[model samples]
Target: MFRFLTAWIRSLSIRRIPMKIIVIGATGRVGSTVVSKLAARPDIEVYAGARHPEKVPAADNVTPFHIDLHDTKDDIKESLPEAGKLIFTAGSGGKDLLQVDLNGAVKIMKAAEEKGILRFVMLSSKGSLTPDLFSGKNPSPLANYLIAKYYADEWLMNNTHLQYTILQPTALVDKPGSGKVSLGNYTTNETSIENVAEVLIGLAEHNSSVGEIIEMSTGNEPIPEAINHLS
Candidate 1:
């Protein structure tokens, strides 16, 4: 098995080895952007993972991978490739957070660990670490969403063996991103889905981003620059 793994890694090498990055939920807004951005890069093989593979975008370096979050563990395992990195962008869109956000994420993490994937970048939302930020008279959905995220984040941090980065972005807007952001604790209205995608891709490539939970908002520095600082 070790020999097969070593040879497989070696076969992917050119002047430098190309890392395979699986972006789960590739049909979503942020996930699609991440796929587009990474698709043109020569150093990475982007597997655009989604339950509906037909909905995922087509690109030169991006391949559609069918991965159903609710599938049995063995089925889900078979759908994923033996890759070195994973970026989880899957969400239940408030429909079934308990199933998708918590259970599905944990299952994927376990699969990634078993496959010997070293890095994991999760596209999480803000307020996961601080639920009080969302508690108010209206009783926001963010409160419940954060509850699921908090436990998932905790499991990844404490239980998983993979190197991880959890990005907590504020309310997601579909506007064009400034490419600038406040990459830590901050107060802001909304962050462009583009910027969040950029940050997720940046952290995946940044070797030093492991174990960091970055809560961000629109700010003054470019995505790469801001991510470098964290590294």
Candidate 2:
């Protein structure tokens, strides 16, 4: 009877363990917001990954993880902590597209796979799905950035076995979030950074939209409702 009781207690203790999630690019505007949101949950341990770990905000349940996307595959794998879910919201801002935007994202994906982190959520840009649209009459300066995102997203889908959700939000504005969003293709090309962060949080916590490429913008539906409505 004592052995049986001990076995039951061990199972209960394992069930009570908090979920660990890592947010890459935790210092960025959207990434920082994600870190703050995730940290508020008592059942989650948030690892805020950044090139400059010092920049990560101080909060309970939040730990600063040092990660340089420019590092080699082995270094990146070594740097990553063991976590169940990972959110990739880092970008190069067109400064070093090849290194930061393109290769950096790919390297992290590979490392995440190697580390056995199964769930991945990528914050991408709108129009990334249609790279050829940027060409012809008027080429946008953001063509390269979109292209990088395209391939990174493709690799996540084709090259790796990680369960991934790629979120493509339109042009981001600095407005506050309404906790509402529109999922799927929309005509408007504007979405608040706050709303994007909220959507990312929903995706991470709910584990919804796996193996899906979601295109989102500011909309009328509540964030939770919109996420739940995903098929």
Which runs of model 2 end up more than 4 angstroms from their true locations?
Answer: 1-15
Check candidate 2 and list the clashing pairs. Answer: none
| 1-231: candidate 2 lDDT, tens digit per residue | 999999999999878689899999999988998998887888899999999999987888999989999999899999999999999999877888888888999999999999999899999988887877577877677888988888888989999999999999989999998877889877467999989998988888776699999999988899999999985
Which whole-number lDDT from 0 to 100 does residue 221 have in model 2? Answer: 91
- Assess every candidate by TM-score: 0.89, 0.92
Question: lDDT tens digits, residues 5-80, model 1?
Answer: 9888888763676878999889888888889889889778989989888887677778898998898767888889
Which regions of candidate 1 deviate over 4 angstroms?
Answer: 1-14, 131-139
Question: Model 2, 19: alpha-carbon shift in Å?
Answer: 1.3
Clashes of each: 0, 0
Give Cα distance to truth, residue 6, candidate 1, Å: 26
State the weakest 10-residue window (summed lDDT) of model 1: 132-141
TM-score, structure 1 vs. true: 0.89
